[model samples]
Target: GRPPEGMWLPETAVDLETLDIMAELGIKFTILAPRQAHKVRKIGQKSWQDVSDGRIDPTTPYRLNLASGRTITLFFYDGPISRALAFEDLLERGENLVARLMSAFSEDRTWPQPVHVATDGETYGHHHSHGDMALAWSFP
Candidate 1:
């Protein structure tokens, strides 16, 4: 198995035990689909609030506590945009692909978080031919 940096689950499936495993293994964080999050409340809030359009704030880190009091962070990926990039097959051209990805986060929010776009390695060639080339060409 790879060193415990992070983990990706199939279909983003997870449960308490899985998160506990992540915490025990020293995994720093994991990505989840936006909808997977029931709701989120600030560290001290009494009630969980709905994220915009049910999408979790990707910019902030969410902490989950295990039964043993260990914690793991969850980073919700931008689900709608990710779906567009994947099923939509919008990476026909590398440069445009970058622009499209960037376009998802226009008009700064009060809180800015890292933008994460995850694609399986197989997506580069097996899923879509030339995906690798498009990714490389997008950079200046």
Candidate 2:
């Protein structure tokens, strides 16, 4: 079978060497938290914009330059939204879950966007109490 888009690394697990190796292995993209993203700039821009201290726009994929001049695209997930669901009881109900997910794309996005949200595996059922039911209901 062919490989999917990319792979994910645990929190702060991917460093320069890891990315260099991944690119050598033919990986093209990955998802990281906003904090992991040091800075970003639109394509063809000369300056790097600093957004790592706060939430980054998850709508666009950003490029990272490796030491050898190779690059890999990185998608930063919605940090504030992820935090809400993880610690602030945002997933206590199906409606809350749906609302949180929808708010990310409520704007008029002209280009295709991937609203990626990352969370701990326990978020599905163990941490929030009957969370799987909420997910099932929200999607079903």
Candidate 3:
């Protein structure tokens, strides 16, 4: 399901009507690229204001509530970290990447919930050579 008002598609190509559509369909939330916010003057300014107010902190997740009382959670990805793993040669070593990720979450002792990594699925065969092998070996 798509998110209401604030849900931004990656490309940010949709229009305001899309929000109406999402609201009609009961979509909760979605993520968008930074550039997407710049398209609409009003919305874009508000987004920037939120960022300035620490409401859009990149290091932590935030929650947005719609007028209908539906809630949507938003997580601004760490662009540098995600880009490093996506494009840097060092990430080819799955062990190194896994260690970094594990370290990032190690402070949390509430165990049992698995850590899920999200990335473009095509990265396995199309972007990085031996990417599939790297993941297979690292995950058991």
User: So what's the TM-score on candidate 1?
Assistant: 0.82
lDDT of each: 0.77, 0.83, 0.52
For candidate 1, write residues 38-95 as lDDT tens digits: 7788888899787656567765779986798999999888776676667666667886
In terms of lDDT, the best-performing candidate is: 2
Return the clash pairs for model 3, or none.
none
Report how far off residue 25 is in candidate 1 (Å).
1.8
Between 2 and 3, whose lDDT is larger?
A: 2
* Stretches > 4 Å off in candidate 2: 106-108
Instruction: Return model 1's CA RMSD, one decimal.
Output: 2.7
Candidate achieving the largest TM-score:
2
Q: TM-score for model 3?
A: 0.54
**Residue 132 alpha-carbon offset, candidate 1, angstroms:** 1.2
Model 3 regions lying over 4 Å from their true place: 1-8, 11-20, 33-59, 67-70, 106-119
Q: How many clashes (backbone N, Cα, C below 3 Å) per candidate?
A: 1, 0, 0
